[model samples]
Target: MLRFFTRSVLSLIVASASTCPARSSSASRPAFIAAFALSPPSAPSTSCQATMTASVAAESTDLPRWDLSRFGFSSPFSDEIDLHLEETAKLAEAFKAKYEGKLGELSLLSAIQDYEEISKRKTLVSSYLHLSYDVSLDDDTLKKRKGALSQRQSEIYGDNLEWFSLDVAELDDAVLASQYENDPSLTKFKSFIDELRRQKPHNLSKDVERALTVRSPYVGNRPLVSFFDKELSLMRFKLDEDGKEVNMEVLLSRMQSSNDAAFRAKCLQVLNEGLAGSVSRTAALSLSSVAGGWLVENKERKYINLRSRRNLDNNCPDEVVDSLLVGVRSAGIPLCKRFYTLKKGILQKTQGLDKFRWSDRNAPIDIGGVSNEKISWEAAVAMVKKGYNQFSPKMSEMFVSMVEEKRIDVPAANGKKGGAYCAGVIPGVGPFQLLNFDGTKQDVATLAHESGHGVHDILAYEQGYLQYHPPLTLAETASIFGEMIVFRDLLAQSSSKEEELTLLMSKIDDVVNSVVRQCSFDRFEELVHTAREKGELSADELDEYWMSALREYYGKEGDAGGDSPFDSYENTSHLWSYVPHFHHVPFYVYSYAFADLVVGTLYNNFLTNKEGFEGRLLALLSAGGTKDFANALGPFGLDPTSSTFWTEALTAHLGELVNEAEKIAKELGYVE
Candidate 1:
């Protein structure tokens, strides 16, 4: 069986399809709650404070939201977690003793079964530790334990299973095919085996692999990445809020819909200054180290190009990703330009602004009919449930059950991580969602988006450890689709044209974010990673790379030359310092564009055939990592490899939204 080991963390609220605007490169992207900072929460509405408090009280009473005990653990310090770790360690030793240096001689069934058993146990323990740490990064004990356990687990895998894939890859194709035909048990592992074989050319000698693995903890880029996250998390930025000195998080939340452009601009200035002054040097060094490691590996591996390494992991063909990039850039950038132009016009008419700042990218257009009031927790849940239930009752039930079981941590508190992500622990234990929910429409969409990931996790649990998680290319299917479903439903219920326009513009922003902005980020990554081969990049060089990408995508404001409304790129240069993805997972940002286009295409099909779409969509999610990207989308008649797929999806879906919003603007007299 393909063991499903699922980890789902998506950040919502980058009006462009990202968790955060900073997510231009994988190094800068957050791992789980990628978008936690993209959209700030609404100020608690004075009118609904009582109701909000009551709802929080009612929800808080049901503590211990996640059922970690199902995995034979409760907390990070629980005896069960330690006992499980000990058991896993022993199993690792026993497995190593049995299989080391004898892998080619063992029957395929025996090899797979042994591997599966060991992986399942290790996943259970490690997954629990990860969940505990994500929810409470401030807990030093838990943080240390998570790190120690992760290192130990890595060691165990290295020591015991270092040769498994290389050996499997070395097997004769005919012999492997014969084994598969003779042993029915191997059928489920076909995808896993095929993916392993893809790495055959790059596989190192067992000794070298083991050596690298053993020294990995100290020599790898992880330490640098960890330092950046720790340093950024610890550095406090003081913002004057209502004459009170508060942390950056407070200002970020207040800045979202501050109604005061000056205040928002100041908050943006403070954020940039703080990150630039204290964090940029560390971030620049980390990126250099990470990019340097990639260059070294690329040379050693002798892969086709800079991205072949990540392409192998994603099981994506080079042509497909190339097509995706070209298609998105050609189709998405112009549409992005059009949307921003419309936005500038509307904001100018509504807010009386001479020109907009980068901070005003997500500024709300105050329409007479739209409500900017804070949504209560209860109402947010109801809205999400209603929206989801419109598509699938099963999905709606999943959201409700998460709430009832307390599987969601929904408040922003000191020491709690920013952003939101669905961490799907091992099978038999449902997924847990972490959110800094601040009761905004974006927050509700985030609720739906992360819930979509939880649903995908729940469905994919049957695939077991190796097959449970989809590649990054297909990873955002359910989550982005969830956002679309909710957004459409919300638009359907809008009472006026202005309200509808607000929702439409937001969704369009998300699509552009996901597609155009992310592709631009990918372009930056390609440049920087290529540049890093020459030497380490200084902070200024990194800023130059960022500004170059912005100009290409957003364009310059005046002279009628480019897409942007201003030339304020200098202030946002340090923005790259905070994205977690770029540091940890290179070449991963394109997956957002890949997912957005795929989901947009799939969603259009669903609209055409609503009666039969649910089953097919569910089946796609359930396949998990067992199928490659093309096969997963085959049912929807979407070919990601084709340029048409990307261009048509962008024009038909995102372009339509932009066109409709323009029409609405003209109708409302905001534009002619």
Candidate 2:
């Protein structure tokens, strides 16, 4: 049985909620990395890396196990947990023994110190479960465990929250005894928890917390959310494209790279139709979950505004979000619309691509696929190793061990899920990763990206279970940095201008997705959360908000011609269905944008000034969860606090990329 956190046990029981970091940092990208050459009939990865056993169920029996390289040494996860659990049992006994009908003279601070071992156990369990759930959702037992775990978390939080309320009121003593404490070491978390406890009035009773948790998983879950997330995405739609029928994603992929506006528009229409079709069932579950969770928590938690809790969870102040909205609002009217204006001219279209045509949000730059060209996963691993070796041989070898020892799995096949993730394995085995390796150049980069995470996890493995993975804001650092390594290496090896442009554009679009689009989403979430705090928004109202965000983030300012009809209330993946975040964690979206913005500046700094900066970069990666984000980058001289840190990172390549895009537009006689 998994142990829970108690107020007397831990400093601040996050007794935290939910998993899934991808919604913030990971959007489902098509199976682009399954092939590195960026061509069809994708080849298999040549590496003999170990694979994890990720398998779900096909109805009752099971989904096939996704086999990758496996490590020979028994996973250290069990040993770590056993040791921690033993210590925790001892602590629990001591707590019960010492505090049993005790005299009132013991200081509150002293009381907490007595239970440190138990607190550590809870932390260890949490860290372990995070990775366990990531790789594969096994049979019914695993799903039940997840639900049970969430309930247990609520119970723990309710306990600590009680102690938290008392502790925070006169927090100096609590601060002293807290594990994270005045040690500049814990840094942000110290402040983060301070704020959480500061808003103790908003929190509800333990019974209420447990009720919300127990009710949550069933409210809208399982085969349902799984269906939308895992199955719906994989469903193929046939589209008539010049007589031949094509899959919607395939057609859209072409529209992205083909420079054919009409084709792009047609593809988007069909995609919209498909999105529209699935609304009813998905909507029913989605809305019920939200409405139910909202009403219950609203009454129990006593938050002044509905969104206040979520906003607090995001680690962003309301003011910061407002500033971001200002940027988006200002951006929508001019810069974004201007790009569309140019695109409209190129397409010779009236009214521009319809709402459905948003599938072309990020235009793809195709460096023609070399039919016979091949880049092997083994070779890619070697390249990343060499690249990182130039800086930190230890980091390079760590990645090598990850791939060679079968700590990574990349499979390319039909009926497979889209996107990639680095799954930090439970407790001691470090992190394993998931990918669809179809032998594309980008496929190698994906390996590099996830490998960076794997290496990061391995470096921090010695930190023990409870303190391995860093905050979401810092998690993307190593992965993004790893991408820069391969990209810079590839750019150096490129024989011609076209190749460089291809790699450059690919890398730039990555930035656009990570920095620009994610920032846009972060802004949108802020608005919704804040407004909802004030009052409940209708489903249509929610959609309208999304449209407004879309227009602001992706549309040109001058493009709007007075209240264009958008079915804002129409088919939304929203509704209370499965998006475990709202139920679990609130306002977790900004971390990606934050991480990207910071990393972008760091990458640019390395590019312009230091040729041999890879070593320092690896050193940062190797420090892992042992250090907070700010200190991790201290070696690199990048500070994440200032607006300057972000602006410098964000605009680093936009100017050049925009110039080249404009030049290409002019060369094609599309007019600037």
Candidate 3:
């Protein structure tokens, strides 16, 4: 299995939650670097280099060089990496022997300290392996090393530390409190311990937990997810651009941006055919295993439903998530339908399409002089920096450092992974960002978004190795905020009403994708998991579930005021197969919706009170997992659990954007 390790034991415990520094007269970089270093401060990185030709650059007009040696290794095959792995294994054995069967007996402070120490060690090694593999997915050596490290970590954990959670769960509350009173050091971990104890009701016996861990590679959804990624890496869609063969990422981007309706349609057709026909059965089996495995485990663990485990993991209540779902279904779907109907009118005038197909959902409206031209790498960075600088100079500085220090790998290459992500291993080392930059406006937003994550990782490092990563519920806050800041900047600076309309429409489209589409994905997962409890679902059945979600969120065809009604999801029935999140992190899609809604609320507050807003926002980013989702947002006067929160956010933010875009369309004579 591909090792997804970061932040040590917490990565496994939290399942994915996971971050570094610099020097200069500004005092910011130096302070961060000093805090990040395990030893003495070192010279700034000088070795990270990119080998991309200027013309062949994918999405990025300018490719970035990433300095990996800053992490203390030159390459995956470095002697230091080998020695570190060996040392990690040795330390794990010793630590296991010392603490195995003694977790309950040890003092709370001692156990916490030991756990933190061991976690730090494990995190550094595992993070290096993962970061290395992420950039070079096609490298067999890195792949093998990553797998070995992952398996070894899992083995050691299953054999030794599997009892840790059970022991923590079973510890008497009074005793734990007494320990905290006796040792002030234990107070720091109060939140962490509280969260562990919350799992008591769902935790299995130590033996059962150990068995699960030991059998993880063969029995869980992760391996199946790995298989899916590998297969997707090989699947290609032939494009009309010079008859070029491209991967799913390229195809999807082209479908969304291509001005030629026929090309877009062909791309969608190829995409649908490629996914539904070639790999649907394999995907179906993978989904079955994932849903079925969760069903079986959920039953044994006594979860309320398939989503219960995820909600618990997110530290959110069932009612809170359900309320969001209900609110989105009731309010968001209609708003989305309204926007798409407006889009249909615009497209009809522009592209002469009487009845839009599913492929037309993402069709861009051509507004002359608005300039959909590709943004250069420097231009994108400048735009992102300007946005961050307006909000927080610290954020802007960090973004610049990432670019100057070559901590980012930009540009899309064949076999390189799609999408964007930021990973930070330890405090002193900072964060690493990966992007397949194809120079679209969307790509620029992705840069801002991932940079936001990097900034969050850096600030949160103050929380230490054990608690520096936020849950998924809060993980997206910084990234989405970064995107919004840049987007709002663009909207404010538009040269004309038409340009403003284009920007407004573009932002609205993104909002729809993030909010409504994600809810639809959540619905699909709900349906699949619910159905899987009865039995395995066929490809056809999964397709129905996928289409059902589409109609629910996007409305039935012809509702968008087309000439005739049609099945909008007919061609994209197999899209669910490509969503790796379904396999890697079940029920994780809703977090995007949660973050978008919450960000809308917070962004409104920032706009209302520009004074000291950055400082307040930084406090939230620095919190890491120290606070739950609600408490983290409490400082901003936002409560996600409130019944009215979702609807209010949808109306005030996304709905308002749609309304503004429609008003603009009318002004432009595209609609009356």
Candidate 4:
């Protein structure tokens, strides 16, 4: 469930459809933080300071910091950055002058090649600045420097390059077809051209487009989003157990891992209260502005629905996304309830809890022969490498190269961003991973997940910058697949039934979080955006939307005099205020469910037919954005457009896992 920021400068320039009408100054990376709502594995009790210190010091000698020098910059203040910026701007101006009004007359292939080169240089600088900024959010100097460069980029692109796509979109269909027929080299950009053509109906006039792009840095919701990140990162919550205040990441980990039900509940209360007053109000404003701006653009473009814009960008059809959502609600809701019901029973028998509150949903169980110890940084890396090696040696080598090349930042520190993400900057630079490696089992899985993204990036480097990033629907395929292989490898190595049961339950927790919990998140977003059309919503109103979604998915407590596993929603109402994806990308959460189910089917195929499966998966990853999700799945003999594809995948994967866990729980006398 870690975030993957795969968009580059070229993506922003080439693609007209965006979550916001005006593109942000730093839109090079999709401002997605996907792990905020995901469930983490359980661990033994430790003080927040002790945990942070241990995480950093445990492998201080071994944990690798990103070698920014590889990006041709010694530091953020390096003179090379400014030199590169000037060169890129000049190149962009020259490109604009050469092909501003001559796209139809010139060789389409040559124009695109020049565009790609400019995009590559622009991405290199922007990526370094943004990546450097993420690790140290509190550094005002770095922040200001990045902002200035981004503004220059915005102006450079707005004035010099924004017309390229608009002009290309206006090209006659016959001209493009003729170009392709005349020179097969033009075929490499077929997908990229098709995307521009698809946005033709929504394209605004040249002056309007230029104005929006230039004013976006000041007028867009990006400033508000930045405020949200800085404000939340500065806030701290105090643990009731030892009166120690911790940041959001540590506090969330405690809420997920603490064996003590009361402690976990207190942590939730502290978290809720910390985010209550001004924080929630500001977040409400940010969310409303982001959604409001998106809707305005949607209306102007005449998109069909609230999610249509994002679906188009993802290269997924509206009907396919609809099927995925309906399928999850119909089949996934029942499966989620069943799993939680089993969880409630096991907790009742093991911990003697009379009532299962919302906070106890992710509480770790005390199954014997299972370790609650923290994993060391080195051990975690070795474990992930081994897991990848078990699946494919080439993939394992990619993972190792990432570590040896110092392409990963592997510790949690104050002012560092919460959650984890893999930034596929551009080709020839490989991928850089940002992780808050706290040494939990979930942290290990996260390492494996991001490494999967890195491997995918390495394989897809051949696609170059223009079509290098896959749509969101297929982006999570490799990460989730990477996690699954690691889980399977560990499960096979379990020494006893107790260990097996523990692993099964943890895996189920992850799957539910990815598929069911993410669907619920998407529902919450749907309600908020749909309601925001009537004016701004209050923080209290936002809370109601949050609770409504939770109730529908988890079921209300004692509804209709029927027994329900979940307790009343108490401190969970304002939880929506903290999820970054809601504010950053509208309707982006469902992609997690889409990817999980897709990978589930593919993994099943891998288990059943080990022959040539590895090559097929690699090919899919290498295809990048050249193919749509449906066509991408064609090689595997799967069709995502089918009505029952989602349901069948859910049943075959999550349902089967739940059934196995329930049987094991019964045999162990934890459930009747």
> If scored against the real structure, what TM-score would every candidate get?
0.90, 0.67, 0.89, 0.91
Give all candidate RMSDs, comma-separated. 6.0, 10.2, 7.7, 6.3
Reference-based TM-score, model 3: 0.89
Tens digit of per-residue lDDT, candidate 1, span 1-672: 112122112321234211211111111111111111111111100000000110111112322335556566656777776677678778878877887666555678677677777776776665566556545657887767666765676577667766676677788888887787778887887777776787778866888877665555556676677667667556566665565454444555666656677777887788788878558999899889989988887777678887877777778888888988888778888888888889888988888866677777777778875777888778988998999999999889987988888787777555554455565555667576666566677667777777777788788878875567677777677778788888999889888999988888777766776678667767888889999988999988998898788778888755445547653553577777765556756676777777778888888888787777899999999998788888988887777777588889889889889999999999999987
Top lDDT prediction, candidate number: 4
Cα-lDDT of candidate 1: 0.67
| Cα lDDT for residue 187, candidate 1 | 88
By TM-score, the best candidate is: 4
Error of 3 at 584 (Å): 0.7
Would you list the rank order by TM-score, best first? 4, 1, 3, 2
lDDT of 2 by residue, 1-672 (tens): 011100000000000000123211100010110111101110000000111111111121221232222222122234554454445555555665665333133443345434333544444454344334334433345445544544444344323322333333334544445534434454423432343354556544445543443443344332244434433334455566466543322433344443454565555555545545354345344433444445455556565454444444333455544443344344322333444344445344322444423434434344334122446556667888887776567778888877766665455334433334565543444455555453445556666666666666676555543345454545566666676777777778877554555565556545554445445555555556556555555555555565666555654323344331221213232322222233223344445445545566677778676865776765665554445566767777776554344444444544445456556556645554
Q: Weakest 10 consecutive residues, lDDT, candidate 1?
A: 42-51
lDDT of 4 by residue, 1-672 (tens): 112253210000110000011111122111111111110100000100001111221213355577767788888888888898899889989998888888778888999899888877777777777678767878989877877776776787778877877788889888878888878998888888877777777777878877766766667776787787778767787775697677776777777777777877787788888889999999999989988887788887778998887787776889999999999999998998888888888778777777677778767766874787989878998998999999999999999999989998887767775555667767887587766676777667777776777787788878877776777788777777888888999999988777888888777877787678778878998998899889988899999999888888878775334345776556897878876666666676676678779999999888898999999999999987788899999988898999999999999999999999999898898888
| CA lDDT, every model vs. true structure | 0.67, 0.43, 0.67, 0.71
Off by over 4 Å in 4: 1-62, 240-243, 559-563
Candidate 1 lDDT for residue 471:
71
After superposition of all CA atoms, the RMSD between model 4 and the true structure is 6.3
lDDT of 3 by residue, 1-672 (tens): 011211100000111111101111001111111111111111100000011111122344347757788778777677886677567667667767776666556677777677666666665666566556656667777666766556666666667656665677788777777777778888787766766777788877777766666565545655665566667666777766687787765676677777777777787788878987658888888888878877887887788977777777667899999999898888988888888778878888877876577777666778756677888888999999999898789999999988998888777766665455666566777677766676777667767776877888789888876667676677778877887899999888988888898888777776776678778878898899999988988999999999888777776666454332232444677777766555555576677677778888889898888888888899999997688888998877788878998999999889889989999899889988
